[model samples]
Target: MTTEVSTRPLQTLLAFPFHEDRWQSKMLIGIGLTLAGMIIPIIPGLILMGYVYQIMHRVIVDRGSLYLPEWDNWGKFLKDGWRLFCVAFLYSLPTLVVSFAGMGIYIVTFIGAMTAAGNHPDSPASILLFVAIGILFLSIGLSILTGTLTFLVLPAALGHTVARDSFSAGFDFTGWWKIFRANTGGFLIALLVITGLMGLVYIVSQIFSMTIVLICLIVLLPLAVGFYVMLIGAALVAGAYREGVENLELAELKLAEASIVAVQEEKPS
Candidate 1:
């Protein structure tokens, strides 16, 4: 029987730079293909997003570092994703409502502060400080909340079990301090690296003429980064779940295998 344990760290879904598995390479290519497909004008971005999740779901099931399904598989995966997307999207409705409310409050606070200070807005430094602080706090909170929502809803659409659970599961996972502590450092490091690379790309692209072509290319650079980061984030979460939540380490699997063999031999089989 196949063990349900997750694979090794170097072989996890994140497909980190050091990962040498063929599946990892294929998954990376798959992500690139999905992103390129998304950039097309007429096709709905949701279609491609669905495919990405489908591919990810298959990867998880295969227990491999990468998963590249055939073209037909892509179609089926997209359909499955669409079905799940509807459910997850509906589940996320409350989050969307709250987000809108938060934005409204944020805008209102800033406007009210400015209006209270009147034409001499520069005079009330305290008001300006309060407004700035509120904006910063709101932004940080939104960033974490949205990031958590992405983890909860997106993968479930792709076939992860958590998506089927109540909406509270998403908040619970995100609020779990142990999970945060385990994965936050790696994510921040990835963010800094990607940011630096994008910065360099932007600088190099700007060396060309300031025509529409250059501007569009510059815009595409960040989109490319954004797509990669999403995959990376998914991978990190997959890794965390495999180790922390599922408790399915490769070493434990090997030990179990050895134990099974010893037991069989002792049984006179």
Candidate 2:
């Protein structure tokens, strides 16, 4: 049976990383992933993303804590990372298209206006400028909204994807809809926890980037804030996934028992 105790989401989610067991080493992995993630041709970042997903998988499936996952599964990590990349990429398509189109429109409008001004054309440059501003704002707002949706849905998609060990699992829209419907409150709470962590990371980093000494800290520990926030976010999603699976499992067990009892009732006494 799934453990129903320790239901406090944040507390349970953080218990692993905060535990007294080799937390320093776990932190070292976080730091390493963060710094390595900052480098180059997307490989390092993808690996780190896969590793974090594995950490979430362990928690949600194996009922493990937020302990650091090992780097030994490089092949598996690459594969999983590739799939997660697919999921994220697919989900971000709308946001990407909107953002690029927005930027393109802004650039074209800026250049056209500049030429008009330089040539002193009779066209209403002022009106064009106002129209450009409105278009820019609207496009930017749409991009931001879509980007936010990507962040919100990616976690749920990732959870399902990893749970089934299939990339297509994440795209199972009907299944996800049911899961979301059944666990809306818990899922929102999880999202809220992650959002809070985001704000905290921003505040802490700003505080750490003030003086020369602190600015140096930020430079030396460039990935610290990001890694910490990511770890917590992964854990919150893991907890939410576990809760959803547990509910489904419990319902299945009850249904099985009910069927057995009904069969017995139909049998001769």
Candidate 3:
């Protein structure tokens, strides 16, 4: 007999992190690690990221289990975190290149416009200014669009990488796209859920900022909120991935293949 797994995105996203018996302790540890990451920079940050990757991995393997893993394996966390960082950095390259190129062009055009205006106001300085402004807006628009698309697609890419336990898996665009297309709605809902939660966190942080006495919390609050949000986001990714796998019937196929391999190995050996 097998237990049925629930891949309902809303429930998974909202309840998974808190369903465990030691949830508060786990959350506090996560928050502390996150705060330490922010305070100490690169190494701690990578470990935190790796820890989040483990969360995603657990969800995917266990079919969205509610139990959080203890933070005992620092070495694994560091390695996983490094893999995640590499994948993220590679994905972000396009956006970074576009943004830098746009900024460079904007700076040149603005300087040209200013030079024209100073040298000859009656000349095509107005034209140059208009061109500069247009370029600026276009650059800004393109950057935002590129960045937004990257943001939306990255979680699935990360999920794939972790699922396969290979960094190269993240670059398997075709595979991830099929997964994304199979359950586009689930992915979008996950994205929207994350965005809404992040916005709420920002608002709460801002409210805390207004209170002078709680000024110290203004710094710590965002870090804690961001880590918690990351956990929720990771769970959502797992849920979406589970739904995608089921929708594509990959899980059963893999299981059948595994059973066949096991039988063949037993008979031959």
User: What are the root-mean-square deviations of the candidates from the true structure over C-alphas?
Assistant: 9.7, 4.4, 6.7
lDDT of 2 by residue, 110-204 (tens): 77887786677666774666667777898999999999877766777888887888899999987765666556677788889778877876777
The TM-score that candidate 3 achieves is 0.82
Model 1 Cα lDDT, one tens digit per residue, 1-269: 88777656534544452344464554455456556666665233445455455444534444456443443455655555455456557556656756666667767776776766776656664375487557757765875687576544443232333333223443443434343344445434444544565566566667633776566666555555555555554454444443332332455677899999999989964
> Local distance difference test, per candidate?
0.52, 0.77, 0.84
Residue 208 lDDT in candidate 2: 82
Best by lDDT: 3
In Å, residue 40's CA in model 3 sits off its true spot by 2.8
Order of quality (TM-score): 2, 3, 1
- Residue-level error in angstroms, candidate 3, position 240: 0.3
lDDT of 3 at 246: 75
Whole-model lDDT for model 2 versus the true structure?
0.77
- TM-scores, one per candidate: 0.45, 0.83, 0.82
Q: Total clashing residue pairs per candidate? A: 1, 0, 0
Pick out the ten consecutive residues of candidate 1 with the lowest summed lDDT: 156-165
Stretches off by above 4 angstroms in model 1 are 1-43, 73-75, 83-100, 109-159, 162-216, 219-246, 249-269
Residue 120 in model 3: shift from native, Å? 2.6
Query: What TM-score quantifies how close candidate 1 is to the native fold?
Result: 0.45
